[model samples]
Target: MMKLSLGPILWFWDKCTVFDFYARAAEWPIDTVYLGETVCSRRRELKPDDWFALARDLKSCGKKVVLSSLTLIESEADLRGLRRICEQDDFLVEVNDQSALQLVTAREIPFVTGPAMNTYNAATLKVLAGKGLQGWCLPVELSRHTLARLIQELEAEGLDLPAEVFSWGFLPLAWSSRCFTARHYNLPKDNCEFRCLQHPDGLSLRSRESQELFRLNGTSTLSGSRYDLLRQLPAMADMGVSTVRLSPELQGMEAVVQRFDTARRGKVPAFDPLALTEAPPCNGYWYGEPGMDRVARTNAD
Candidate 1:
């Protein structure tokens, strides 16, 4: 069975809400829980100590916890933070950028490559593996055909590092120095007053025609249509993907995890993805098509 891994929470939320969210997640059937802030460093609802505490709790629940580094590390402060996460040595660390990879490589510690890292080919995978990469996350834009080819090649070479795919949630497209959330509120990025928490799951971008377009996260822009792959569980399993990552949402996360869990276990009669989220679900990337296209529409109104 393909294991379920809860990706780190990318959106900002109140401290109490964040804690309560994970408190409920601890009871889910997920095998892995990624902790820490993967977006803006300014979002400090959970500090390093807080992440460690949460990770410990999740680990106690028999879930493997991974500390995720920021995708865009721009400052000495960010470097220091990455170094601290690398030094912890208590849990797995997911490096999202080259700087974090450099630190992990230098320390000779095994780490997982986060989806933000542009790992496109087998050569890149080999180089990272040589640097002690224990797992690899396929970039969101890469199709399942590409992933299957890479996995097949790796298997032929007998390099069987665990593979994880971004199975659900909004597709994170880009990260910038400016926070779109603050910009939308007519505020500066540095002194924006942590405004991203106001819009859980980030703010939705709409076309002038009132059509859903993209999501403006703090510094990251995501696909307007959430990238859902619940209907493609069998394909992911056939591709030898060891884990399916479900990114956190603003609400209804526990039920989402439960549904995927049941589907993966064959307990459900037919996987009803309509019960997942409010956004339109998509899995076109898996079939080598546009990511926002739906392979299986479940009438999720």
Candidate 2:
């Protein structure tokens, strides 16, 4: 069975909301939960101690908790934070940056690579597997065929790292040093006032034709369409995906978890649905098409 995972919260929420959200999640059917600040370092709604506390609580509930590192580390403060996560042996750390990878691998800390890591082939997976890699998430842009090929190659070489797919979220397209959210508000990067808190779901960018194009949250830009793979779970299961990750949203998360849980348990076809009821659902990257394009599920939905 392909286990369901809740990716770290991508949107900025109040500290109470984050705690309350996880408190509720402790009872959800999710098998794995990733905790951390993956975007801008300025948003300090939760400190390192806070993340550790939450990880302990979640672990007590029988959930596998993994601390995730920042995608774009820019300073010594960020490096120190990554060291804290890598040095700890209590939970697995998700490496999203090259610096984190180097630090963790050099220390022989067993970790997993996130979608942001530049792991596109079995050769990269092989190298990381030797460096204490417990698992890895495929880069979001790779297609089902690509994953199938990589899996086939890995198994042929007898290097079977657990495979995870970014099954649902606003596809994180890229990262930049200058926060786009701050730019949206015409505020400089340093004094941006943590304005990402205003847009919990991210600031949506649309083309002049009113087509949803992208979303800006802190230093990252995501696709405007929420990439959904509920209907494609059966196919992924057949392809031997070990896990499916759903990025956290402020609202409707419980229902989203429940829906994926139900579908994964039965290996059944599911109607593609959006949790927050805004952007149209997309699965184009999974089908080797432009990520923004919505590819209909041939078998269902």
In terms of lDDT, which candidate is strongest? 2
lDDT of 1 by residue, 1-301 (tens): 9899999888898889988988999888999999988889998777889999999998998999999999999899988888889999899899998888989899999999999999999888988888898998999999877998999988887887889999889999899998899999999998898888878887888889976778888898999898877777777777799999999996788878888897687564355645544567777877778877887543321
Residue 46 lDDT, candidate 1, scale 0-100: 77
TM-scores for all predictions: 0.95, 0.97
Off by over 4 Å in 1: 267-277, 297-301
Location of the lowest summed lDDT over 10 successive residues in candidate 1: 268-277
The window of 10 residues in a row where model 2 has the poorest summed lDDT is 266-275
Local distance difference test scores for all models: 0.86, 0.90
Q: Residues 1-301, candidate 2: write the lDDT tens digits.
A: 7899999998899899999999999999999999999988888999999999999999999999999999999999999988999899899999999999999989987999999998999998998999999999999999999999998999999986989999988989899998999888899999999898889999999999999999999899999999988888888888889999999898898888888988898745435444484997888999999987888778532
